[model samples]
Target: MRYLIVILALVMMAAPVYAVDPSEILKDPVLEKRARAISKGLRCVVCQNQSIDDSDAQLARDLRVLVRERLVAGDSDQAVVDYVVSRYGDFVLLRPPVKGATLVLWFGPVVIALIGIIGLVLFFRRQKKYAAEINRDIG
Candidate 1:
């Protein structure tokens, strides 16, 4: 009885996920695959962390619809992405171009990591020098 109750609760929780209409299936699976691939690379402007392909937000859904609309209209993959990027700026792309404006975003992490490593090396070297001084004093 307890197991049956738990299963029923799980089923109820899962039901809302199927709210997407049955007709949402793409007529051309190949085009749909390409559309999904492109959407996966574009960030959801409203939800910066989630890709448009992965986000459940209305804006993401609309962007997804736009992607499919362009694809079916005979736009090449690069053309589709370029259209979105032009409208939203390079920030919309998961991979931004390596350019002057985005230099910090591209290289900031490596620069910080190098600084941190240098700091650690200096600290250890200073600690060793202090230990040597203390040893000399004791002798």
Candidate 2:
């Protein structure tokens, strides 16, 4: 029983982790490849942190089907991406473009980190000055 459980666990671990169902795959290998490439660059809106290709969310599945449909309907890779962007906005992209609108998304973390570092430096300096005053009074 233990050996069977171990084998099952190993098989599950070895399985591919992609969310793309076999039914959603395109008949044309080239188009399927292109769809997969595009999917990898798209963010799953529901999962936020996961690419649609890796997310098992219902919204991700819908996005995957939409991408395949667009490809079959003769949309270029860029066009398919644009269509999704038009509907879902830049947040749907895994790597959003660095533009005026997205500047906060790109730099907000750095700005916050700088603020925190400055605050820590100020705090430590204040503590050192306080300690020096105490030492002077004690001596």
Candidate 3:
């Protein structure tokens, strides 16, 4: 029983989690692949954290359909994405381009990490100086 449970756990862990429905799949393999790649970069407004490809939300389904519709109409991948972005704003993109107001979103984490590192360095220096004063007084 333990061995069976372990095997099941391993199988589950190895599987990729996605919410693509059989009905949603495009008939053409090439177009389907492109649609999937585009869907993976879109955020589901309802799910918030999950990409549209991994989200079961109705909005995600609509967006996926929209993506396919645009693809079918002969729009490039970037153009399809831009159309969605135009309708839903940049928030729909999981990785929005770092331009205009999004520049902060791209660099904010780095700035925060630098601040933390600077704070840590200052704290260690202060502790070392305090230790030296204590040894000087003791000696």
Q: Which candidate comes out best when scored by TM-score? A: 3
> For model 1, what is the C-alpha lDDT against the true structure?
0.87
Clashing pairs in model 1, backbone N/Cα/C closer than 3 A: none
What are the clashing pairs of model 3?
none
Cα error, candidate 1, residue 118 (Å): 0.8
What TM-score would you give candidate 2 relative to the actual structure? Answer: 0.64
lDDT of each: 0.87, 0.95, 0.91
Per-candidate TM-score against the hidden true structure: 0.69, 0.64, 0.71
* lDDT (Cα, tens digit) per residue for candidate 1, span 45-94: 99898788878788888888888889999999999999999999988998
Model 3, position 6, has a per-residue lDDT of 100
The candidates, ranked best first by TM-score, are 3, 1, 2
Clash totals for all models, in order? 0, 0, 0
Residues 35-74 of candidate 3 have per-residue lDDT tens digits of 9999999999998898889898999988898898889889
Best of the two (2, 3) by lDDT: 2
